[model samples]
Target: MPLLNSPRRMSHSLRALAWLLRYPDDEMRAALPALSEALHDERALIAGRLVELDDLIDRLAHAPALRAESDYVELFDRGRRTALHLFEHVHGDSRERGQAMVDLAQTYERAGLLLAPGELPDYLPVVLEFASTQPQAEAREFLRETAHIVRALFTALLERRSAYASVAAAVLDLAGERCDKVTLPEEPSLDESWAEPEAFGGCSTQGQSRPGQPQPIRVVRPQPAATRSAA
Candidate 1:
């Protein structure tokens, strides 16, 4: 399913990569072949990079369904280090992240796409979907803008020896960013990830509490401080 070597061929790699990063539900697991086809057909990733992605695909496809799902939850839902939410890496829980979330969602609306309920705009899969809908150059630029976050995730995944690192590497290749080994500092626990800044109010994230429970991110905004001094 190799793509025709035309300069103008719209690459579906962005969406494919997004699919690779999603929660491995039954539907997604069944789409393995199509997902693999798109990655090769797009020809956006080099052969070496394709090999890495193929390896990840094989691991995910071959693992038991529950094992695959649990593994994904453990790897991505454990801490902020491997967070799929891009803003977590860039802005943590500051007020700026909220505004960025709004701006990104508005951008999606302007492009005629609406997010499903419970979807966050900065989620890697959602961001990639938006990029996939854009013109080729625009899509590349979109990936380029987020390459720093993508690369950090890559390093974090690599540290844990997760197959997901391959997907992040492919993303880096697509963005024309360098994909080399990097050392990321340790990731904090869910409680530690919620540290409040001295200047701004804090944000809190709730991760999985029990084994096999999928990690879902919820941002808790602090109550506003009273502006009046002892009136």
Candidate 2:
């Protein structure tokens, strides 16, 4: 069967996943109803994965705000394995990673989407947000390019038995791919990795404009002053 590729539907899926991946502050909890509504219209495309995410969101909505935030930090921020920055898997502090980041930021700019200061282009949510702006076929092709990264994240989350794994699974589903089991490297100690200054070294500021630094503005060069209309 052909895969689901509704641009509007996929956008909702991406938005929901983006919200879910962020730190679950009170704002996130409060937005659960609207988020739920966004997904409700796309149930058929998402299949059971929608239920899985809705259930997870339901729990987050009812849980104490602080507990929800703590769990998010514990699962995503405390470890590198489940990190949502896609290039971390492929580039890992290499110079190539920096180039890839620049390329992706340029891609977004070409689409007229400017990222906020301090945002990383490889961050899954940001990528999804970019995909959400594309046409259906274009979005799917864009997503397929990163499908492997999503698969890897799904594997790590499943191993940890995290509910957030469902969010990753949903991403694969939207990309029209199945999650495959893969052997992942041993995870380093969270404390050690966090303590290292180089942990986020390469391409760390790829999409960010530093505070007080002039943000790169996109300018369109004026067309050669309209060919002189010599009467």
Candidate 3:
């Protein structure tokens, strides 16, 4: 809602944003701006979507009883898109964004619809790192990957709804299972302390022991005296 300019508005926005922040599907992302606009202008696309959504809700009322394919599919598709769009929209600063994605994906699965596995993508962290760096090329590539993933997910749903459950499960298993074993360094004794060689002014020399190694010994050398000239 207009980004919460007033204290009251801000409070309202924060609460609403908190709720919206939890969704991360394409529809939610697409719909949020419209939703906000609708709140302001009343004649916004958001109002239109909301009206459509209401109609869908009406269809849902009889669901599995009346069982109209077109009505149900339309409602389901709109709901799905709205969920996704909201997730994407709040994702910018919403702490609940990731959790929302997980919940939304699971919700679809629970409803007997095949959907993508909800495990956070590995590329997500990489893209976040790239975003923090703000490199133009990296940002563009990250956005591209995000769009591809979104498209792939929807395509899977629309084309292979029947195959979705199995595929989503597989994807989740692969994403959640750890493939690499983590090797932890042995803990050091309290008596153990790091030391360095004085020969190199307490710095490591070439081919010295690697990190986590105890310090090396320093060698002592005697100073040479100037020689007196012999007559």
**Please, what are the lDDT tens digits per residue for candidate 2 over residues 1-231?**
224554345777678778888888878788888877787775634556777888888889888888888888888876767888899887776578899999999999999999999999999999988887887678878988999888888999999988888888877777877767678888778676655443233224543544345555589775554544432
lDDT of 3 by residue, 1-231 (tens): 211111111222222222232232444344455434433443211233334433433333333433444432443344322223434423522346667666645644554544335434222322232232333333333344344333433344434342222222222221222112122233333243233346654344323654456666789775555433331
lDDT of 1 by residue, 5-93 (tens): 33644468888989999999999999989999988887777788788889989998999999999999999887888999999887877
- Roughly what TM-score does model 3 have, to 2 decimal places? 0.20
How does candidate 2 fare on TM-score?
Answer: 0.79
Q: What would the TM-scores of all predictions be?
A: 0.79, 0.79, 0.20
Q: How would the candidate models be sorted by lDDT, starting from the highest?
A: 1, 2, 3
Q: Which stretches of candidate 2 lie over 4 Å from their true place?
A: 1-8, 191-231
Task: Indicate the residue-level lDDT of 204 in model 1.
Answer: 23
Global lDDT of each candidate: 0.82, 0.79, 0.34
Better of 2 and 3 by lDDT: 2
Clashing pairs in 1: none
